[model samples]
Target: MYRYRITAEIRRDLERIELLRERFDNRGTLPRRWLGRLRRDLEAESVAASTMMEGVRVTVEEVRRLLAGDTPPTVDELSASLVLGYRDAMSYVLRRADEPSFAWHAELVKAIHDRVMGGAFGLDAGRFRTIPVFISDGSDGEPVYTPPAEDLVPDLVDGLAEYLESSKELPAPVVAAFAHVRLAGIHPFKDGNGRTARVVAALAMYRGGYRAPEFTSLEEWWGGHRGEYHTAFDCLGKRWKDSSDVTPFVAAHVAAQRIQADALSLRLATQREIWTAIEDRVE
Candidate 1:
């Protein structure tokens, strides 16, 4: 029962992400050295930020050490699984960006969930939720929002996949945003729903060639604004199942895309200047 109401504001934000995406469409806009700088610690930072949004008490330092094969100080299994699993799954999304073999499907989303929470929570990963759950306001208070029933999750997820496939008329960013909200509203999985929703959004963009030459994580941006993020979710009302407009969530997400795109552009430009100066000194 959800449809993206693309306002003029959303249009502008999609345009913003598209411009940078066009710059990197060729995938060689940046020199190999610059690419190395961008890729150097991007994945770790992105994964760390994403896990943090999932309530993991982990930091980029801990993640970097863990990646370096060092034991993190006081890193528990939950934190470890979230950090590593999301990193692996994020790698898949970025890898599939270049590989044409990956296709949009419901099962593809499930596979990403598997990488996200499979081993972390036994039997709950990769499968749709069989039991009901509640979205919360970080309180033991009454449920904030309840998603569709388990029986409805499969159909709802499939509808989203079908939207991705059939909505060729829509801009990739817009479709990606819709995918993010739709699956999130469905709350398909028992756990990892939030992470999976964000990943699915990334998948839609990366697969659609929506990337800038520099590295940036939409998750990182969202993680930094958890209050605003939840506030947007709260707009769906106690009964998200009722037909309610999602303009607030869509508009805010698209606006954040512009903020991130601008940030990356500035970062890349500064890096370019530094790289040029280094080249001149080297010669």
Candidate 2:
């Protein structure tokens, strides 16, 4: 299992998340319809960013179009498939997040990958790799990290599921972070590992009661801060070793959540002002 401690800073960040979550839950005067629109926007942004991280060149606008069942002329077939596939996967995660019977298992993980990569290309959809896979350095295509052999993937994924099941005591953010890093490290599927890992992390947060709209937006942050996102995985080393402390990666995940919460706070304040002004005008 990945080792991490909830440091003082992380604890403080979690407090901030709690505060912001409270604000989201208690919307004061913001209308539910307005929140619905914001949620859709977040969904589009998330789909675009998560797919883009895997080198898909779809924009948020394109994603919105695809979600609306309209295809942009400029979006290639591959990009369209990638965007829509991810949108479906995120939708699946959102639906399952609140289910009381949800369990972390190899099938759930595979199902997420299936939704993400099912028809995007001819690539293997939900099955673990039958051969070796390597993470390449972006520019030169040189191998950077070697995932565990194909034989170990099924057991490793099962172990991950067990860990998630038993990690209920940990904070949601920590569990989310660990899931993200571990899945990425495991590279269980032949492709879509990063996307699957992110979706799994989002599921963790949602199940832990962080299902507010703003919580779904971290993939946008990760999309923009790709360098930091990849660097955070340094704790995993060049292989799937269990010895390294993943505190830094967990800290980074918490920080991302905090940042998103702060952004949402500002947006909420602005919206509240607008709402107040409209009320005064109507009065």
Candidate 3:
């Protein structure tokens, strides 16, 4: 099983995230229509961010247009396909998050991969890679990281499912962090491993009741800070190994939660002020 110690810093960060989440939840009540608009906007942002992390070149506005049943003339079919696929997978994450019977399983992971990669790149959708895979920098095409042998992919992914099921007692952010890195380390599919890993992390957070966009979506932070995001996995070394400590990745994930939550708080305050101004003008 994958292992990581949740240091004191992580705990404090998690506490801060919880406090911010509490405030957001307790901020009286916004009209359902307004909340719905926010949800749609965040969903578009998440889809764009997650797909863009995998090198898709679609903008958030393009994704929003696509999600709203309009095709942007600037978005090519390939980029549009990737964005719509990710949007479908994220929609699944939101639905499953609300379900009382949701559980971690291999099939569920594969299903998500299918949604993410099935449309854009039909390379082994819903299936683990039968061939070995390596991560390469686009410039040199040299392998930066080599995953486990193809033979081990099945067992490794199954082990991840088992670990997720067993770790239900841990805090949501911690579980989410681990889920992100573990699946990423396993590199289960031929492609879409990163996208699958991210969706899994979101599912973990959502299932743990981190339903707010600020609490659930890290793709925006990750999409913007791609370097820091990849560097967090340096602890895993050049290959997958059981002994690798994942503390750095977990800490980074927690810190991202805090940053995003803080940003959301500020954003909400601005929105509230704008709203008050509009009301005053009307009066």
Best by TM-score: 3
RMSD of each: 2.3, 1.8, 1.5
Q: Give me the displacement of residue 208 in model 3, in angstroms.
A: 1.2
lDDT of 3 by residue, 69-180 (tens): 8999999887777788787887887887666787788899998998887454467777888888899877899988888898988887888888888877888999999999
Taking all chains together, the TM-score of candidate 3 against the true structure is 0.95
Q: Could you tell me the TM-score of candidate 2?
A: 0.94
Candidate 3 Cα outliers beyond 4 Å, as residue runs: 118-121
| TM-scores for every predicted model | 0.90, 0.94, 0.95
Candidate 1 has a TM-score of 0.90
Give the Cα error of residue 269 in candidate 3, in Å.
1.6
- lDDT of model number 2: 0.85
Deviation in Å, model 1, residue 56 alpha carbon: 0.6
Clashes within 3 Å, all models in order: 0, 0, 0
Scored by Cα lDDT, where does model 3 land? Answer: 0.85
Residue 159: error of model 2 in Å? 0.7
